[model samples]
Target: MWAQAKSGPLPHPITAAGTAPVHDPVPGELYFWPTTDVLAVYYADLGQAVPDPGLIRLGAIDTGLDDLAHAGRRVTVRIDIEGVQ
Candidate 1:
């Protein structure tokens, strides 16, 4: 769990590109995103064959009410996704 949401899409994608993700928080309504199709459908682990974004599920994260704080606002968090190379 990472953020809180009231409704709608998560403020950010789930397990985004990274070998070491800094999980700093978790919420009750939290959920690993980009797992289901409606969110994301594809993902890859670098050298691994790139799955179709429509069929791949590389990661998920937590988002909920915490995100709604800046509702209608723009927030930016950086995740480092990379190639196997």
Candidate 2:
């Protein structure tokens, strides 16, 4: 699943540069495109390749992918940090 900003890029505090941008991402992988401020979560391999500069690796989903795929096309998502308050 991927979401792009309709108006413009959203404000963020990420200062880290892209170290390992991937051309082909696998399932359960997470990525953030800095240029477009788009966030994506791979539930399955779409057989698509990312453009140049590629996508910044965020992390991976260890579980609940099946639930995600079954949640239909649109769903609200909430991200919770472990210790950041």
Top-TM-score candidate index: 2
Q: For candidate 2, lDDT tens digit of each residue in 15-67?
A: 43738778788777667776778677777776778788887777777777777
Root mean square deviation (Cα) for candidate 2: 4.4
Tell me the lDDT of model 2 at 2: 44
Which 10-residue window in model 1 sums to the lowest lDDT?
37-46
Q: Give the poorly placed runs of model 1, Cα more than 4 Å off.
A: 1-55, 63-70, 80-85
Clashing residue pair totals per candidate (backbone < 3 A): 16, 0
* Local accuracy of candidate 1 as per-residue lDDT tens digits, 4-84: 322234455545444332222222222233444123211112223223331223334334333444544354443333554
TM-score of model 1 relative to the true fold? 0.21
CA lDDT scores, all candidates in order: 0.32, 0.64
